[model samples]
Target: MSRYPVKSETCHEAVDLADTLLPGNAGVTRAVVLVTDTAQLDLWRALLTGEARTSAVPVVLRRHDRRSLRGWAQRAEVFTTDERLERLHALTGGWPLLVDRAHRLHVELGDPDEVLRRLADMLADRSAVRAFLEATGVYADPALAAGYRSVAAEFGGDQVDTEAVVTAIACEIGDEGEARWVFACLDALQVFDREEAQLRLEPLLQQCMALGV
Candidate 1:
């Protein structure tokens, strides 16, 4: 079954592109396209893909695993032992940015544990990562501030409202149909499960989103 409600029948790219360029609602597709600009995303949503688009805004962070982490570690100058490297990869869920940051921290601090500790500490602080998480939470610019506030509120609350946080973030995206792709693509946050329709924020992301809420 499709992740969202839409018919999936592949059509000629030229035909689709031409229809997307023209004014009228001549053609649309359930196929996804990643666009950089929010304005362009809106335009695409209006003209070409409609609800099927997964905007590349806030750029998706691809996850890393042991093999990929080893490759990344090799590229970095840090003195990364296999044990330490594995620990770092597991801790960050192989999110490339975080992995890079952790690598830098390991190089600077000289220990994976130290790097993890500092990262944990950063998440503990209210202001440090809040902005970053909030910025990532947005699917649309108009709802940016509101999305941040919504996520921040959840952070302040006693319990971690996974559903609420995810739902609020989805609300920021104008189109409901495209929310799943957005959520699934959040490899950085590692919170949303596209298949299960679930949201379980990782520690770093939980703290960040909470602060953002």
Candidate 2:
């Protein structure tokens, strides 16, 4: 069920609903999939601990990749040129929410460039960046998130050096573990793929940084 908080009362209800939805609880055993969207995820973090721990696991769904984005775009009737499609994929980085919005704009307006430009603006907004960062599970602490946002502002969607990010947060927040958790959460969110020692930020996240949130 959607919009149910992961609080004591709601969780109890979720347990019953879990039994109702998946009687035997086959694969996940006592899990309730509450569908909702928000930038504040402290409630989600709460479910990871205490008595409700086993009953709920906060799992953010993975975004699409280039191949999947292309397929999704085609299905959405975003019939643009291959070059434009590549640009769209680069800008959206296969984030489903972004691709969904971009494609609709693409269909409505004939100019592919205009659509992408507008989409980039949307992603670059402060509120959008804050929401995306929180949703990635990387910024649990407001102070730490703020520090990292400063570093992102410096980079402005350019190639981000992973070590620099870690060191910067460590310096600013003065907590090595919390600093490292940023990358750890990003990994869990599937936002970046590490090739060798290089950690490449996905395009969607890069745009968020460009927003300077």
Q: What TM-score, computed on C-alpha atoms, does each candidate reach?
A: 0.47, 0.60
lDDT of 1 by residue, 50-147 (tens): 34442323334446656777877778755368777766755665655667678778777887678888876765766656544544444344444444
* Number of the predicted model whose lDDT against the real structure is largest: 2
lDDT of each: 0.50, 0.61
The per-residue C-alpha lDDT of model 2 at residue 68 equals 69
lDDT of 1: 0.50
lDDT of 2: 0.61
Give the runs in model 2 whose Cα sits over 4 Å from its true position: 1-31, 36-40, 46-58, 110-114, 120-141, 150-168, 180-198, 211-213
Considering summed lDDT, which 10 consecutive residues are worst modelled in model 1? 1-10
* Candidate 1 ranges with C-alpha deviation above 4 Å: 1-61, 77-83, 135-203, 211-213
How many angstroms is residue 74 displaced in model 1 relative to the true structure, after the best TM-score fit?
Answer: 3.6
lDDT of 2 by residue, 53-161 (tens): 4455567667786676777767765735688788887777777667777767866886678998987776657787687666555565565455546556555445556
